[model samples]
Target chain A: MSSATTTAPESGHGHHHHNPEDRLALLKQIWMFSTDHKVIGIQFLVTTLLMLMVGGALALGVRWQLAFPWENMPFFGLLFPTEGGQISPEAYTMLFTMHATVMIFLVIIPVLAGAFGNFLIPLMIGADDMAFPILNALSYWFMWPAIFCFGASFFFGGGPGNGWTSYPVLSAVPEAAPGSGFAQFFWLMGVTLVGVSSMMGSVNYMTTIINMRAPGMTLFRMPLTIWGMFITAILQAFALPVLTAAGFMLVSDRMLGTCFFIPSGMVINNADPTVGGGQPLLWQHLFWFYSHPAVYIMLLPAMGMVSDMLACCCRKPIFGYKPMVYSMAAIAGLGFIVWGHHMFTSGMNPALGMTFMISTVMIALPSAVKVFNWIGTIWGGRPEFNTVFLNCVAFVSMFIVGGLSGIFMAAVPVDIYIHDTYFIVAHFHYVLFGATLFGVFGAVHFWFPKMFGRRMDETLGKWHFFLTFIGFNGTFFPMHLLGVAGMPRRYADPYLHPYLENLLPMNQFMTICACLMGFAQFILLFNFAYSLFKGQKAGMNPWLANGLEWVAPSPPGHGNFAAVPTVYRGPYEYSAPERDDDHWLQTEPPKSSPVPEPPKPEPTPDSAPVGEDTGSSS
Target chain B: MSEISHDTGSHAHDDTHHYVNYFLIFIALCICTGISVLFDVFKGGIPKSALVFGVMAVAVAKALFVMTYFMHLKFEGAWKFIILAPTAILAVGLMIALAPDMAMHYYTNDAPQVKWVGGEHAEEVAETEHSEHSEHQHEHGGH
Candidate 1:
């Protein structure tokens, strides 16, 4: 920040203060776009939701066939209908692979990092906008071509079938499946775009958080949200390049015939494949290097959001705030080490597996600390029954369910048995999709009033919650049972065996539940669109939640805080008996606020009323 | 001009983030690359001892870079640097844990069985399972 210390003091308000009269042309602006973090967040939000549905539907189709093998699915043939009725084996493989890609790269990564991280980082840190606005917009726009390439996979006769890991031989050879080599290319290209987008977002976040805290808002005084975003960006900065490099190698192998992942010797389609002298496990090494930390990338920010939301709603000073901070740092550090947990069954040595297992178990400790801190923050505070509060609680509950099951995978022997089983599916979906997505939902709802100047329908929100909670569990929970009964995964038709027959009924039940979960979002869609106009008009601080965000004008004016807001006390100042207000705002100075000189009697008719209270003094 | 407050009172030229530091990184990287390459060559002659020392050098250099730059300790606070120091050690420690399994695969009498395609040029190399396994059909090799 120093070389630039004398750089140029910003216009502070210049970037955001341009009048509407001087607006850029629509087409021109769309091409070059505004660098407003809010705009970038919305861009991420809309794109990711569209992809989520497309991916979710794919999951339903796969589940549909597995529950009832050989049945007549709407399109793409049968499950194995002797000839054709539901999904084909190739289609099944394609479904599984594409579903994972859409969920992780499109849904989780963007929604967590791109959407929430972009929207909140600047606002939370009290900056007018990101450090580099144009670059931020470029990073977001870059995602479009990447997504287009990914969606193109399905139409290329089929999508990637290498199970999202895209291991060589299976992913490298054209004969690996009926899919056109397009799937591999699409996966590589999509991930590359995602990596690029992540890198840009990371750099922007790091720079903004470091350079732009409001006066008196020192590092410790900054809210946990900023802390989470900062660490996530740091992880992304170092980790994403490895994945980008890995994706390029895979791209070259598929399109240009250079084998970075394929080992020496092998044949495909009765012809010797040119892919030789490449290590299959090396791809795993590089991919997991980015991706395992990527899991933390997805989780930590949401954890940060959930932490803020819980403390705000419960009106309590964040319990053990410093410990919570320490835990986040610990988790990010431990995350890089535990990638081997994913590779245990990839033929890693038993000693290495044991070491990974120990490291994996250690991660649970910091996570446990975070969970305890959340619960402690809310323990005795008068709880609000608002949508945001409930969702925060839901996030914690889901996280607990998600975290506890991770222990199963943390153990070496347990993972070996359940390595590629539905059990693994159940465990991660609970963590990644269930817990993390719930955190996102809570954040959106919590921030909706602040973003839109309108409060969401509580009734509809509640209905949305129950249906999602039940449906998510119903959909993922059965996989645990099926996995236990030794029903092998990745099969288009599991009913091929009589022993697995009992699980089909459960599978069908799960599929039906999954569809119900899909429909539950329609309530959300209704809530989102309907609330835009007809919902109750929310003034600033609708929930009376305490944080700097509430103190800013509703919908937050061009610059975040009206005046420079200095921090007074910690983030969660709930039920501070010393104050009359039940919830304490972060920008509100403590009990003995200030005793300014007794106001001088004003002259006639208020010439220009002088001596206003300039925000707060810490 | 916009007013962005700078607290230069506690600030000085941060040697770690200064442009000059880039040269240091470059020099360090060259040395690391040199060490790795040297070890690889020496392993051809004294494989065991060179392999151990070479990796150790690369690991130390990488740890230094991460500590000084990515973690931004050289330009920032000791507390942050202290927090940042261990992740590199953790990553390499994890890698070491996996080394033995990779070692076993390389050393075991077992060789990767290469399946014959189109029944051409299938021949055995010193009673190996892979090159001549047209009819042998090892169990683990198929999947």
Candidate 2:
């Protein structure tokens, strides 16, 4: 990781190295440290996957309990026995809480926002790498302390059980619960670290996307993955900081006797505490203000990847390409106004609830447009429903199912009834598992060839998708019914409601589905590892995607394209008659456009062939 | 392709162009923080959020001067603005969102355990207290 810099001097041949590589020393240097964006992206991806497995295993333990409540189980019950009884109420709460936190902050967000976002941004835009390489390394490292703190809570005391939302009355007072003190601290620190990592990553991505696009690669003539990452980064820049402040405020209230989130005269265990006059709702306002947008920050990049992959695999210009881009911006802009949807049942003002409801309903429109655009994208094209394409298509299907459930909750009256119930559970799983992780699977399969220069076993991948998809829906879809039947979420036992007798069977069924879903991840793991060593070699453009990354060598070198690409047309120019192939890379010139697009070559790359900028496309 | 460095940049000190505003700011903040700490520890009075934010305002002003002149964010690129615009939006958004919650703590009159807020409700309550017993009158005297 050293380079020679030629310097002009009286001694004409003299040059110096900023970091001179001496063979053995250089190997150690490269092994110990390097600030390459690709290296950092790979590091983030690997870290995210490791945490995913750990989190997933914890989830399996949880599912085991629900499937066979208070019974001796294979792995989890034995490991987490509470004095030879069942898993304790506190432990069960902590496990569920940490599982969600780890999966969201540690896995899905990092895998997309930090990993693929970093790995793809420079390559797609034809830059060597990210704008600030050293800061990139620091951001990844900063994530570790936060993770370590959260992990350490298991040993020091109870883990955070306030749910990933960390609603204040549950999270504020250290003495509020058995786990609140140390567990909540660890959770806050972990979340805050993630915020720092995301902000740094956002700054790097936005700057690179803006300042480092190759010659002739304008804004509109870029892949949707870049557009997704760009918007996600912009959203992160706006969202993560508010959450950071929220975490800091929570910590201040806990440790320093600041009454920022506690109101006077509240009784915890029939005892009044010293802290007073802070409102708990303040915490919710702050937390959700960041977290609601954080949902898009979590999911949008995957959507971008799926759109790009689906277009390429189908050999069609993406249907309503302009709508896809504008819809994303609309989603982000609308995201800020809708955080109150989460708090409608938390005793929010009825008027504000309606406003938030309308915004929440409005949020669904952009996504529905995306869903329509996705269906239309695959329709009327020479289709190739490969495992990658299936996963891509599945992302839309799952998102629709998940997204439609969101509309039910967005209606203020329905939300009041189902706010903290299993219906909410079904709604989000349809989102995180159905949509976000569905996109993640597509991304992993679609990019494995580019990332490793080897194709994943298609059959194994299909098996993985089928089992995960069915298991996911089977597990979550019933929750909507359970929630409507008054099955409260985050409960250790359904017996909390004596009258809800019939739901036990449904709960058991969902738990079984959840366990089976967890089991299928191993198929993916096997496919990933086996393919790394034993898979077929994927030459560049195996799927024949019309993006710049494919034109570069497979397992692209550090500099990506051998020649810096000059982008020439919209990313979705496909199936045109003038082109020999069905696709056109954005980096290719319209004048050099082999495909016959009927519209005249106006050469305006920033806008749609016929559309306006600076306004919503609708 | 060119290789990246394996070490932290050593030329950081060689440049020797330390920011004047940053230096002056560091000195000024150090003195102010010293005085504030002394006042709090000796005088037995601590600053509120408003005062702390005021101090932070001064520090932020100083830091911005340093970043523009020293860190060179001022001349960096349009992308830096692109990066920063959203951060500004989020900070303002959080304050806007948090304001109602803070206001609600004082405004929600139905909650009896909490004290009466200094508003029309408090005025109404004060009138009632004056009409009631001497103890209620004492409670309403300063409140």
Candidate 3:
């Protein structure tokens, strides 16, 4: 194990002298089935973005019908040319259901946990690659069949229409809903494939994080981003199997004559009921059990990435690093028990509701701790106002709103009213979109150079961020008012009831804003594309960050580091009085020795700097 | 750093003693399966719920044997339990939350029309079905 800090740049370039024939074969390997973590990360990024576009298109269709009831859609209506281009109630149901499914399962989880998690975990922890490279590759490739199956669901009697939860009775009996038959089967198949992929990825992540860190890179010395990926992988490993089993039972109920969820003596579409001796509430119990932890699964990596970027740009150590780590762990631990919060309105025992409500409210303590720690990281420091920093700050601000709004729902009495309203919709988007997407954007901006060896234009990036911020607020913030006005969700037409008639103007406003926000994302796509070739070339340590990733090449090669780096201190070491530069690199050997020596002695607490002795610095 | 290069692979070892132990565990698992079958064969005298509980206990024991021996969890460090703890706790917690629904019957009769996803017309359908279901329950006793 040679030190990467001593590796020469010329040695890496010397490998380029291979013959053209060999080069072509190498290119094929790199593009097609390479097990390199960076390549897989890019693959996850591209695939999940495409899924996001598909899901976004569905959302636009949903918004269109809600804004202008019975009105003809322009470009998208051509896809479904029934009822003179107007979105049918049936189509609208499929749109929203698939939207939630694609976004939750396909887009957010893969992008945050799959793409960035794969790319950053090894690099930050000073590992060469994932512990199981083949499994890492399989994780990304598995999504292809899943994406295909999800798309195929549309052709087979329309897509799943009982919402993403696919509640039984509606999902069990094909006669109950239009898409309940074969389409729902495809939905289950697609979800099961995704679950398998995620579980495999989780195992790989856990093994790599625990067993593959560089010599001195202890668990506490690793970056918060690594911690984030570690906990998220654990969450995925445990939670995804339950979802897989639920999906299997669903398939059994629909295809086989097994009565797992359908109760006896029930009529479907005004016909004789066949299934017997099963509970519909059982499906809710299983789905939410997996889904509650899934909420943390989506956001934890983002929070971790945001923590890293925030510490880097602020030019200071992350405030309360141990607290940050513990809070995230606390969130993951509490996440599993609080699933019943989603079921308060769901006719489970009302006594259990009190238990879940207490657990759910207690989760806010850790959430608040994370928020205060982020603010503390930025306090009294000359923070860089780059696009990444702006996005991280926005994530914190919006996450505050998201967390505070969650309290309203955490209280059982308040939740009983807003359970299925647009307010619930508003609350989640603020967390998912406002908080998580902002973190995703920040991370893309922060790590774009490392991933692509070039910088995204800061001007375009900042413009994209501001427009998205404003558009996002305008789109979702009004939903709180609409919810308070008693507007029910999942309705294709908000004009169905006389009470909702007054909310039409606000609904139309949100749709327009949502369209603007949707269109503004193209700016990011353009920035990403154009910056790939045209932007300024980035150096190895362009940001002058403290992580071990800075010791590697800009876009690291087959093996991330020439030699796995030996860490001397924690990832974030900023404003140390002994260093000339404001930030200190983790890979840098300690300078206390009178003479610089080869094969430096491993850094122990006795000889390290003041901050290094803390043992928990990130 | 050189010493730690292959630390991840250190857990893999070929020990004959462990293999013999695994074989012994496998035999124990087989014996448990046979006893569970015997309980089922003589089901006339034993209580039905006790028989169910007995079978479930045997199944749990079998799963533990497989996980410990075949899965190599017995040789692994404390981190093995760290992984299993949350999954087991949450599973029990979910069952706890669901206990009321499973034990106590909530609704007097199954209202077939009152589907969660059946929307507005389903509610009206439920109104008609409610009256009919109550009469049916009066005649046949609730299912």
Return the top candidate by lDDT: 3
Q: What TM-score number comes out for model 2?
A: 0.81
Binned by DockQ into CAPRI classes (incorrect, acceptable, medium, high), candidate 2 is: incorrect
Q: In model 2, which runs have C-alpha deviations exceeding 4 angstroms?
A: A1-32, A589-618, B1-93, B104-143
Better of 1 and 2 by TM-score: 2
lDDT of each: 0.73, 0.75, 0.82
Q: Each prediction's TM-score against the native? A: 0.80, 0.81, 0.87
Q: Mind sharing the TM-score for model 1?
A: 0.80
C-alpha DockQ of every model: 0.10, 0.12, 0.13
The pairs that clash in candidate 3 are A572-A618
Q: At residue B102, what lDDT does model 3 achieve?
A: 56
Residues A1-618 of candidate 3: C-alpha lDDT, one tens digit per residue: 235555332311233223334324533554698788888898888778778778887888888888888899877688668677877788888889999999998999999988999899889988889998988999988988898888888877666898998899899888889655788999889999999889999999988987678877876887999888888887787777888898899899999989888887787778786657788888887888789889999999999999999999998999999889888888987887788898888787777888889989999999999999999999977798999999999999999989999999999999989989998999999999999999999999999877766789999999999999999999999988887887888988878789889988888898999898888788988998788767766767678788888778767777888875777789889888887888777877777852324444445433332222112111
Q: What is candidate 2's lDDT per residue for A1-618, written digit by digit as tens?
A: 111011011111112221222222422332344677666776777688788888988787677666666676566556556557467777778888888888888998899988899778887877887888887888888779878977876654667878888877668787777656776887788888988988998988877986688766667777788888988877787667778987998988777778778766667766665446767777787788778888888888998998988887788888888788889878877887799999988777666777888989999999999999999988987877688888888889889888999998999888888889989988888898888888888888888776666689999999999999889888889989988998788777766578666788887898888878888888988998787667776766667676767666556666766666666666777888987877666655455555533433334333322122212211
Candidate 1, residues A1-618: lDDT per residue as tens digits?
111111121211222222332222311333446677776776777678778788887887788777766677765463346665756677788888888888888898888888888778777766777888888998899898888888787777766777888877678777766566786787778889988988998988877876666654566666788778888887887778878988888888778888777775566667663546666777787788789999999898988888888887887778888788778888887887788899878876667678789989999999999999999988987777877787788888878988988898899888888777788888788888787888887887888766666678889988988898899999998888777777777878877788877787798899889989989888887887676556666666666666666665545555555665555556666778877767666655444645322323323222321111000000
Any idea what lDDT model 2 has? 0.75
